[model samples]
Target: MRHTLKTLLLCLLLPSAQVLAEEVQVAVAANFTAPMQVIAAAFEQDTGHQVKASFGSTGQLYAQITHGAPFDVFLAADDSTPAKLESEGATLGGSRFTYATGALALWSAQPDLVDHSGAVLRSDRFQHLAIANPKTAPYGMAATQVMAAQGLLEQLTPRLVEGQSIGQAYQFVASGNAELGFVALSQVYRDGQLSNGSAWLVPAELHDPIHQDAVILSKAAANPAATALVDYLRGERAAKIIRSFGYQL
Candidate 1:
């Protein structure tokens, strides 16, 4: 312990001193899993801070947070969650900000399966259609809203397969367990284009805008690493990664 203290003191006195590494626990929405992983890597490289991320549906994470889970930051799939946390005094005052605006996609691993216009929904083409649980995932709510706007939710209800989170919903389609699924556009897109299979980008008008927000938890309000992580999330470096995944910055 003395030797460690001496090293820290020496470093503090040195001209080329490095900051001590700090770890932050972040609760992330499932839809942002890919980008968050990439961002966490970049953040650690840029700063000597470590990030411990937990991914789940926004509602699930929010519940855990309200129940005193020791998460330092909350990255929700919907803006509402952050606002609710703020209202409930779970987060630092005025710490919320929209990090990304998400878009939905009708994705299928089969080529030429989902037409761009989504007319395939009317036809009896596939057996299973997957969606995340609407009660938990905001993307699932958007998916149902899109179907309702297209007047196909009732017809499609009988064939629906539900996943616990948006990431799982994507898995169901990617693994071919379901023929087609309502997934975040980011899951199927990379470098400004669809990465694989067939996908129909859902029209923004069909559902409300998915404004994902981030907030620093009150429990971590004084933690430098936690604040840095939240700041890094809204920075250009992370924003670029987010856009590459097809999420709106």
Candidate 2:
């Protein structure tokens, strides 16, 4: 009876060990937090592989990866980060792919404060505008482009309160630190609809496309869990979820 019990215990332990070995560590862009969380859950459910995630500004993540962060994959807010990693041989060649195109939105906590026609930008209805720090966040780059396209950059510069990441930028507006701010649309969407606040979806013509990309890190290229994650992101299911988050395919 003792021998039989030991055999059954070993059988159970073996599969648990295999499962533990299949886990992957992902470093994701802060802007991608919402969708990445949803996808990570689905990925684990479908594949029985765990995902450990860390979120931060893409620039910060780039610095960490360069210094040998143990992230198995990188989901960047822009293509440039992945490209840089690839050029530096930090990422597996040919594993880089544009996963989504992010959109910029001018949002306000007050219901009618943001004019879809972008007239509020010129109206001087409010005193402050917030945006992510262009030096670190891709959305900030797009925000600057939108401001410049509308000829508001110089005028708005003084009123601008810079957030280190898109999440912080959203907080500035939500907290009324700024009457209006440029933020990712995904941040304000809930249950397939825009939140109670008003927003203007900036036209793509206002800026270069915010192409978000993913790549398997060179250190994890041979890791089954890492490779699986890259493949999972490219799969149809993941793409659909990404699109639902207001990102373009």
Query: Which tens-of-lDDT digit does each residue in 81-188 have in candidate 1?
Result: 899999988889989999999999999999989999998888889999999999999999999999999889999999999999999999999999999999999888
Candidate 2: tens digits of C-alpha lDDT, residues 124-179: 79888999889999999999999998898999898999899888899999998899
| Whole-model lDDT values for every prediction | 0.92, 0.90
**Candidate 1: segments with Cα more than 4 A from true spot:** 1-21
Q: TM-score of each candidate?
A: 0.91, 0.90
After superposition, the stretches of candidate 2 with alpha carbons farther than 4 Å from their true spots are 1-20
| C-alpha-based local distance difference test score of model 2 | 0.90
Instruction: Evaluate residue 116 in candidate 1 and report its C-alpha lDDT on the 0 to 100 scale.
Output: 97
